[model samples]
Target chain A: MKRSNIAKLIIALLLAFAGYAAFFIAPDEATMHAIQRIFYFHASSGWAAMEGTAIVFFANIAYLRKRTPKWDWLAVSSVEVSLAFWSVVLVTGPIWAHPVWGVWWAWDWRLTLTLVLWILYVCYLILRGLIEDPERRAAASAIFGIFIFVGVPIDYLSIRIWRTQHPQPVLFGGGGMDPRMKAVFFFCSGVLTLLMIILICQRYRLEQLKYEAEELRIAIEERGEPQITQRAKVKV
Target chain B: MDAARAASIILRKEVRAEMRTRELLQTTVTFVVIVVVLFSFAFEPSAAEARRYGPGLLWIALLFAGSLMLNPSFAKEQANDTIYALRMAPVSAFSIYLGKMLANLLFLAITEAILLPVFAVLYNVSLWPVIGRLAIILLLGAFGLAVTGTVFSAVATQARMREMLLPLLVLPILIPLMIAAVEATDELLEASPVLDRTWLMVLVAFDIIYFAAAWMLSDYLLEE
Candidate 1:
């Protein structure tokens, strides 16, 4: 095993511990007690997910326009990372919402937007699956990826502008965190961002290997004298 | 020939082609009006509710109808191998883009024009200010749509899910135009002060930016 991979594993383990500490070991909230504390991880991780997805989408656009492979690798990795974080957000939300809102999922504005954003991205991955050609797949997904990103801010704004009756944001001004809370919050968010980058690197390397293996398979098949793709000819 | 004549020549050629069968204009307008009627029947006829949803329904109907018209524009060219003919012509692809854009603008405008009075009666809102705002926003919005649409249409043609992919890809980027258009329309209907000269100027800036983009990128879309 390489050093960076080992370090990434260490960091991942640390994140798990920190996340556990934030949830259980941290001091109780002044108001909502056990439930509100979930806000720390839920909100921060959700924000991180949004950021990662945005970066993935942007990299996809750059890949499409420039016809570069590195951007595609960057994109697929970040999206997978986002899917993981999205799970964190989704899991933590029901735990928090069940006590506060008295329901697991309501048609609230925040939940709706997150749902739309998630579905939009799931469609992004499905698009990749449906296409046969890599370049075409990349270009099509890149375009849709950028589009989904544009929808996110507007989705956030639309909830604010329209009268959907969703609750206004609870956390304001650095979430009104106490000193101790702020320290832990900053620690988790920072480590998670770095953790995301490391995760993306490893995932990207795997995707590249997969792409190469696919190329080799195609090449072996073409050795039987059939042209598969105009692009695979040169790349393989 | 002069620039006006050259542009005019392109416009004339496009208009003539559409007028011969009228498929482009006919299908778009028919579908748009039907959509408006369907909206009225689907929702309750509350004046306030209809007023709020009018701009959204109007723009959405035009967009979907416009997409229908746009698909055949390029795919048909590939059908008869007319794309090579257009490519071999002395005229620039930018000219071709502008010509098609103008035709789309005309078709969309006519749809709005016919629908406005009917929508007004159904919703109990005046159509004049909306028309003025639409004149600026629709042309600007349609230009952005056409610019991006033509480019994407070319790209989608090579892909498997051209039908589904085009709208999925387009709606996200076009949200800004929709927001701006709807905001402008809302201000016009309610006569708000927020949408003064600056807002109209925004519409102008958007138009110029996208028109220039269409001009610059038209060739990239045309090249094999």
Candidate 2:
């Protein structure tokens, strides 16, 4: 099969499975009732975000060491996609919080830290949008990517040290999670990883197209006005 | 050789400009005093809670007021495209950063210095010992802020709406530092027996880490 077909298949399967699991596979927790089911996707999206962001961070270190555009492109794609999935986790978290916590937000450490992460990524996106030079954009973003990774430790400690609805999974034995909970948690994590890969592929393709378009734009600017339609720019 | 000369020139120019009018300090301190006074309206003028909360409150007000001062601190440079001009002048970007960071640090320090005394009087606490400990914390904490704000000012220098972006970018990371500083201040204020010398030492460590990180990474950020 073509790579496109395989990518599309993976994306579809992950989304379908995630939707199915949300209503069917996952059981409501003993404490939180039906609202607790959101935890599956919430935790999964959060996991995917952390996992994908680690890729971006490592890719940034590679780019800075190598001074390669390709690595920078990869890092940007990974972060943008990670931001999208993390956005899902952030929004759904509040939905879950409203039902359980009896309020939309408290200055609880997990919630506050999550909001901080959300704002940081939003600033990341805003930074990308504001820069016109590719080299400066990559350089600035790499600097920020490295600088801001400090928050990851803070986010981790915020939950373990504070009372929060944010569940800590027993991955490396934080605590022994139940057998059934472990199964659902791992399943959600698996589905989300597949989803992250698909988004990364899509975003990387878009980056390549963007590079081509910039080349075309530079050529046109060097020459004269070309016969390009208004609709074409919109499509781009 | 010549760059050092230019750097000193930049530093002197900033110091002279600040000393001539004391505009930055005057504005920041005045704003902080008002903010503290406003706090009294919000939380009745009681003594006990005020003394308990006063240290954190002063620091919080100073942090916000410092950023308010920071936003315009580089305005003159950005307005005339002087940053580009400065870049052209063969001076190291690090020197330019040091000049700006020092200016901001002084402005924040002045504001913090004034506010601490006023906060003590208002809250009715014997503030000399508290002020001494608090001074060390603010000095270290302000260095982190200055280094961070300087680096981000370069990033924000290129953006259309910097006022909006600077806080979003800086505050998330600054949260950890603020918590540490406030916790340290609280311990000093309450005379907590558990107040370890290690925590103040941690603030000093944070100042060093972020200061070095910002300086080393700034050339990358400032590249054309």
Candidate 3:
């Protein structure tokens, strides 16, 4: 009955429809029939992941300018969400590649950049976990988040040059897509964007709950509650 | 109260301290020598193969040595809370970052100067013809490394597992710089050496972008 739940229900239905459309509505490729379907998922996930990076970039900048916990929470939520989407991209790319390229992986520019982006975000998360103070952690991670986002383009350009100079077999044959396939791809991308928003919202709520719990714990300690257990002192 | 003057003073202090005890330079040079020599044993590359791979290997060694050398950039300031003293000085916070960044760049240059001959001998690559061009690439790459490394060093110094944190935070971000440096170095090591303009441009752009980013963020980075 709630607005968010209604929105979630609509997104779930739309995602299911998109799944069906990708499988049946999209015309079969002249080459690599069923496997070509993976392109829809892979490409959409890549776009969503990039969008997530953009959100985190802005969130990080806003945090730095405002020094607010909400922006930090949004940045972390977007990073985790984007990381999941990026993982999907990483996993699906190889699945499509193993059959199409005749190998599971190649040092192609795009592929290498994807892997590097994954590693960069993973490091961002690791950096966040290492800092204990909330404000310090947020500020430090925001700075790092900005650094990682900026590096992506430079990484792409350098890797593009490196790969071009050492030309590998062209992985994706360039041809005009069928209108139906194009439509399906865009629809899937839209659906994935909605899914990403839903996931980020959920993750943001989780961070909010964490902040509340920490506040409650501190308040309890302030009240001289000797009965409060210290067992939760372990660092995450 | 000039930032440039303050930065120079900090640089002078860093130089004086290092001159008193050559800990970073001595250890880094020794470590890099062992890495370069050990790499030759590991690959046993012929002259042609060494020329093909020597630049890549040399850059890897320098990267590791740079990371090792950079770890103590801010960590040492913590030992006596000298960082707080620096912060209290009547100067912009960016000066502290610039001073440390330049100091790290100087140390990396010295380490590279020592390791270049060792790499040439072990890998059987001739450097006499390409030394000038090679120096240009090394300076650009070293500046990129120092600019980012010094900032991350300040960051990691406040974290747990500080020793392990710097490399994880720095190496992934430095991949583009590494690619440009190694590629440019590879070209210079060729039989008919010509520095490719594209990779050199990439190195220059990378150095400028990171340096500017560090300058803009220096206030936040140095905050306690």
Candidate 4:
């Protein structure tokens, strides 16, 4: 069995366990009840998304400092995974919100900030696509990524200063959580973090494969030779 | 050359070139005026309604107009290969960024100066009472815009779809600035206005942070 397959299977099992714990074991909230179950996945995905972006931020910095293709790969992979998790956050957020807040979307700070963060990363990907040269694409995207990350705090602060319709932070809201619920929350977080790692690893491997493919294509184009397949096989 | 000296030299070069044409300024101001006029016709709001929503509308114009002004800042350098020349110079790359940023800031300030009175008259909002505070907010907000917009302009300059890409890259990143600027302007536009120190601080902090980030990371952005 492949190591990658093993990791994926482990992640899948953990996700299922987390979901079961969230829906079955965790006591229903006194107020929101069943729908609040979404909180487990929703909030955990949010944390994973943030973790993904934070990795992207560091990957960007490392790429600039070391100029390694691996750092660029890390940056791109993390952002792509982060986007997937952020989509989950966006989707699940509205699901939770609609039942509780009675609206599909809230213009509240965190929600709005997350939406904008998603946009910024999407633009980051677009910027990368627009540049043809790989080195330039990596460098340009790193700079843009740093700027986007810097803007995150500013976005948070602006929303904080100006009170909006969004609910206050519930995770650390200092409101005591039921002990079992807290356990479930941390359990969900742990599972999601593992999921994030698995996604990043898979994506990073995809990037490596892409780099190899590009190199093979370039070698074929330059030499007009049949060496590409053998080289690719050895690389794999 | 020293960073400040290099920056001033780039600033002077841009200003001199801009003065010769005034293309960016004229087009941006015209665009802004047309936008304001179109909004008036579209909404046709009463004086009270105008006063309420006017600041938001004004900043929207400024945001779009500032983007128009910034798009050309680096794109023009591409035409003459002047960017290459600047890159080859023995100056810190940050100097080039700061210089372009300063030039964009000046152009935006000029646009705002023209648009503010026009906005005041067109929207029937009195500007005299809040001019000082309004200037502060505009300066801070515009500084924020120019910092982020200038950097994005450089990145977008190399894109095939440079024109469309500039604003796409800029607007999302500038939301914090927009929030601070719009809310601060809203406070100033109120009948019983009190300048929100918090929003002002947000604007100032963002400007400083953004400018510093651009300065520090700029060397990587312009690489070939």
Please report the TM-score between candidate 3 and the true structure. Answer: 0.95
Ranking by DockQ: 3, 4, 2, 1
Docking class of 1: incorrect
**The best candidate in terms of TM-score:** 4
Candidate 3 local lDDT, A102-187, one digit each (tens)? 88888988889889989989999999999998988998898898888777778989999887422242234755788899899999
Global CA lDDT computed for model 4: 0.89
- Candidate 2's residue-wise lDDT over A75-130, tens digit each? 88998888888788878988988878787766776666767777777778787777
Better of 1 and 3 by DockQ: 3
lDDT by residue for model 1 over B60-87, one digit each (tens)?
8777776666666567678789888877
lDDT of each: 0.70, 0.74, 0.89, 0.89
DockQ of each: 0.19, 0.46, 0.80, 0.79
Q: What is the lDDT of candidate 1?
A: 0.70
Candidate 4 residue A40 C-alpha distance from true site, Å: 1.1
- Lowest lDDT sum, 10 consecutive residues, model 4 chain B, at B215-224
Give the lDDT of residue B129 in candidate 3: 85
Real A-B contacts recovered, model 4 = 0.79
- What docking tier does model 4 reach? medium
Give interface RMSD for all predictions. Answer: 4.7, 2.8, 0.7, 1.0
- CAPRI tier of model 3: high
| lDDT of residue B67 for candidate 3 | 82
